[model samples]
Target: MDGQLLTYLFVGISFALYIGIAIWSRAGSTKEFYVAGGGVGPIANGMATAADWMSAASFISMAGIISFMGYDGSVFLMGWTGGYVLLALLLAPYLRKFGKFTVPDFIGDRYYSNTARSVAVFCALIISFTYVAGQMRGVGVVFSRFLEVEIDTGVYIGMIIVLFYAVLGGMKGITYTQVAQYCVLIFAFMVPAIFISIQMTGNPIPMFGMGDTMASNPEVNLLDRLDGLNAELGFDKYTEGSKSMIDVIAITLALMVGTAGLPHVIVRFFTVKRVKDARKSAGYALLFIAILYVTAPAVAVFSRVNLIETVSETDYKEMPAWFTNWEDLGLIGWTDKNADGKIQYLGDGPAMEGDGNKPAFDGVSKGVNGERVIVNPSNSVNELYVDQDIMVMANPEIADLPNWVIALVAAGCLAAALSTAAGLLLVISSSVSHDLIKKMIKPDISEKGELIAARLAAVGAVVIAGYFGINPPGFVAAVVALAFGLAAASFFPAIVLGIFHKRMNKEGAIAGMVVGMGLMLFYMLKFKFHLFGGGTSEDWWFGVSPEGFGAVAMFFNFLVSLVISRFTPAPPLEVQEIVENIRIPSGAGEATH
Candidate 1:
């Protein structure tokens, strides 16, 4: 069968499975809606948690970034995965012991202040909404390709699909749906990698294949060959890095702390039965996530090698069908600067336009005035206009894998996109309904009233998310990275201090959150969005990129909170007792409704 038919078959079946799971696990009460009634098994919850965490960034774009960034790309691998250790060891058990429906719930009750709770609610909304937009953006891209629809229409369809189960089942429905999604997505991610690995290095496992000798040419190491090829094409060495060390360390640290603080991730622990189960759930999540994380580097290696070998200096008229298909979709584009029919991947380099009549991929031209479409190559070497997001999805096609494998990748990308989108929507809905309405606006609202409100909030959040997807603020990778920075700045410090600092008053907590999160947002808006005229790297506080600035903001949060808490009055006696209880293991009982 052709690729589109196979895509329909695989993607259709995956959607069917999710819908079935949602129906079977429809939530009946507010507790069920919010935390799956705190009864989900550790193993099952772990699968859902993995699905929740391994989003479009992880499944679709990460390897692609790694493919081009080379050693500099390891920052994402370390940053995103490292925070799980912090989550498992530091925050998960304590938050699970607190037994709340949302992160704001813990902040409200633990800090014993409606104002702090309100701030937490606002921050959660910002972080979750920003994160969800990236996922929806991914959904739009995949839907546009697989379903043959415009990007906006695809985003609208994605919104409706998420609205169905997320509103119907809440966390209960989302959790089970995510478990099934995890299976489909994981299978989708690995199959192509395994196939390509064996084809290249005679190994079924991608990680091992990354280091093994090439089957096609055993005389040279696969990585060595890639490095030589990269240099020959005027790119940096494949195994070496190009970023400053401080930026790498800073970006990785920010992502790690940001991961630890993400509200959607923290909320998953609330669905389990016991504190121990929460810890185990986190451990299991790390294990499942590791499966993809380890293989991702391998995928990056293969894709980089294959892309360079296939596309560089190849004649435009002889390009593969996938190339033209993507080009027509406006994703890939080219203009021969030297008027040569062959692509020049390194058009922007020092040797271009005059040296040896240096050829160049002069980027996408509008075809206006008979010019070509505009293009953005990964590096100065402009042979490819392939966006970083297309790395993994285009992997099988690049390697000439069968149609079925390409279709399976489509299913996996959807699973990855939809799973995280559902999880983020659940958090958004709960924050508005449970945190804002039920807790703050109508403290006496009935459980039934709260549940209804939650569903309404889910609908509203979907609309907002869809809008942002259609009109994105940044690329998938950049937006997702900013979300991490927001989480790291706003939530991580407050939660960690709330658990450990008995003397931490509401005044201190609120100030820290305001300042820390405020600084991070200011930096992103000024830099990423070009608000307030424009931002320059020269204006960065200490040469930190917007992506790495979150770690700096987090430190400021800790510093501001600790300094202010020293002068402020201590928390109330009851709040102190609550904090103490969360730190222990034995007295933890069922979370109250």
Candidate 2:
């Protein structure tokens, strides 16, 4: 079968499996909808957690960004992986012991205030929506290429698919569905890495293959060759770091704390039966997540090497079919600067005209050299524009990998995108139905009414998510990192203080979250989106980039909370005791209230 047909087959089968699991495990009660009745086995929940954690950002964009940013990309790997460990070791068990349906549920009861719950719900909504937008964008990118649909149309399809499984099955359906998605995504991610690894380095294991000598030239190792290629093209060495040390540390710390504070990943532990089981699942999830995280650097090296070897100075008319195929999608472009028919991929010159690096094509028209006619063609010597987002998806085609391998990648990308989308959608819906409505607005609402409300909230969330997907703020990983930064600033301090500090009161928590979240938002909008009287890197406070500002904001949150709490009355005796009990290791399973 051809690649397109195979892509359809693989994607179709995976979608069917996800929808089937949703039908099989559809939640029948508010308990099931919220926490899958809190009875999931550790192993199953671990796989589900892994699937939920590894979104499109991990599977599609992480390596893509690494391929371009080189050593600077290590921050993402370190921050995200370290953050998971922080979540697992420092947060999961206590939260599970507390036995709330959501993060807002825990905050509301633990702090003994509906206002605290409302603040948490607001934070959760912001974090989840920002994060889900990346997943939806990933979906659109994959569908636009494999299924040959417009990117917007692809997002529409994704919204429909996510809406069905998420609204129908809720947490119960999402859990089992994620288990399957984990398997598919991991297999899909590793297969291409292995194939390209052996083809390029004569080693089957990608991690080791990345360090092995190139098959064509035994004298040079892969990384050395990659560094040489990068130098030849006026780019930074792949092995060296370009970002400042402070920015690197800030980004890494922000991502780490952000992962711990993420409401969606935190909620996964609540699905399991016991506090011990939550700890067990976190271990299992770490193991599962490691498979992809470890392979990502190798994949980045392989894809980056293959891209430079294949595209640089290549003739536009004689370009391979994959080049034209991607060019047709307007993701890959070439301009005939100096009237040369050959392509130029030098790093010194801008490949695009405006601030945007992406090409704005001229409606299927072709240049004289058979390159896609881009309206925003630059005057720079470089004539190529390849979006970094395409590196992972286009890697298989660039390496001339087999049809089955390519098809499997398409399926894996979908699995990664949809699994996390479902998880975030659940977080958004649960916040509205359980936290805002049932817990606050109508404490006496029926279970059925809450379920309906959750579904309706999901529908609204999906529509909003689709809009952002169609108009993404940045590339997948960049947007996701910012979301992590938001979580770090807003939720991390509150959750940590709520669990560890007996004197932490609602007034302090609320004030801290508001100020920290507000600060992070202001920085993000001004630096990232250029909204709040936008400023350049020179204007950044303390030399911190927007992506790393979360750490600074988080510090302010801790500071504000500490200062405010010192002046405010301490928590009630019952709330203090609840905090005391949450930290105790004995009878943790029975501590679920």
Best by TM-score: 2
Our model 1 lands, by Cα RMSD against the true structure, at 3.6
Candidate 2: tens digits of C-alpha lDDT, residues 235-268: 8899999889999999999999999999999999
lDDT of 1: 0.85
TM-score of 2: 0.98
lDDT of each: 0.85, 0.91
Highest-lDDT candidate = 2
Instruction: Single out the weakest 10-residue window by summed lDDT for candidate 2.
Output: 349-358
Model 1: per-residue Cα lDDT over 1-593, one tens digit each: 87899988998888888888888989999999988888999999999999999999999889987887789889999999999899889998898888886889988988888999999999999999999988998998888876788889989988888888899999999999999999998999999999999999999989999999999988878999999998887778889997777788889999999999999998899888888888889999999999999999999999989978887888877778777666655555666655677777752553221111223344444442232444332335453455677779888998999999999999999899999999999899999999999888998999899999999999999999999889866557778888999999988999999998888888888999999999999998887777877667668778788889899999999999999899989888988998888887774665664
What is the Å distance of residue 574 in model 1 from its true position? 1.7
The TM-scores, one per candidate, come to 0.95, 0.98
Q: For model 2, which pairs clash?
A: none
